[model samples]
Target: MGVLSAEGVLLRRSATDKDDALVQCAEALVALGAVGDDYLTAMRERESQISTFLGEGVAIPHGTHAALGGIRRAAIAFLQFPEGVDWDGQDVRVCIPIASRTDEHVDILSALATTLSDPAAAAALREAEDVDAVLALMAP
Candidate 1:
């Protein structure tokens, strides 16, 4: 299965802070049976250790090495906050939460980095009218 899915996409979500964004995306993965409830905590811990902000209003949040037990599979959850989130010092509008168990993390991160590196793609994501548009951006 692919890392992204309809159930994992969120558009114009309202998150007060980083923890809120983490919870929203983690819950999406949990709903898809990709991760356990502890995934949220693990994601938060990872964020605390290192900033996930990738610039261009995007942040890819994932669990720490110790939190691997919480991941049931390799999956990704997308969250869009039109209002933007204060990710450390960067204003992040797109949040891609990842739950991975294999070496796929590198591949996924690389792909995401490539996509987010494009100014048009990043802008399209921020202005996306629906989930399908976001999915198109994530499509390989």
Candidate 2:
């Protein structure tokens, strides 16, 4: 429904989609005060269902259950790796965790996925040193 708080942005020096991804996602959600221990556990369990992948060097590992009273306020998680994570046998680096009940979230992710695929956007995201810089490229 709304963009996550600035605190929700997690700038990962290294992106990971395995068990390590959970920690980074949880950190960002916790910083926003949108996630708790219960939500974290649910998210971890949901990962076993299926792997969230976006072709062209991007994958999103998300939790389906939800946080913020099970309403799914936690919309996304950002975990970027300098090297990359092996996803579905493909090497991926940028990770964005997503959970939402609103259409905006889908739109945003679509835009990001498109951007990540674009040569210019991908280059910029790859070079970014911090979340502020990365957000700038995605910002309108």
Candidate 3:
């Protein structure tokens, strides 16, 4: 197993629910930058062709290594759309954006699965009104 834990993952309270998935994913990409140089732009470029929706009112937007400016680290973000974002077949109110260029990415995904797989966490996130409240759900 990898070192995927809820510590680095987060649940967020987005200001607006009408945000475009592309935009939300891009912003998350910036925060998880490894190359650290214009990572947002690179993320958009990577996202131009694909939708990273993971089903269940959630979307996982991914950026390739080229767009990441190189290096590998998993960045996780929890986005709660007040209304919801149109994604593929379903409307997503919750999104988890993750980017990684190394094996650590696996750990991130593992952590994500472990955390989100919990019914309590998902329920809490849906009900949480603010980032602080969301973070509490992940608290030990």
Give each model's clash number: 0, 5, 0
Summarize candidate 1's per-residue lDDT along 12-46 as a digit string, tens digits.
89899878888888888898899988888888888
lDDT of each: 0.84, 0.62, 0.56
TM-score of each: 0.91, 0.75, 0.62
- Descending-TM-score candidate ranking: 1, 2, 3
List candidate 2 stretches off by more than 4 Å: 1-5, 15-17, 65-74
lDDT of 2: 0.62
lDDT of 3 by residue, 3-58 (tens): 22334343444533323555655565555553354555555665566666665566
Name the better of 1 and 2 by lDDT: 1
Candidate 2 residue pairs in clash (backbone atoms < 3 Å): 14-81, 15-80, 15-81, 75-99, 77-97
Residue 81, candidate 3: how far off, in angstroms? 0.9
Tell me the TM-score of model 3.
0.62
lDDT, candidate 3, equals 0.56
What is the Cα-based lDDT of residue 57 in candidate 3? 64
Number of clashing residue pairs, candidate 1: 0
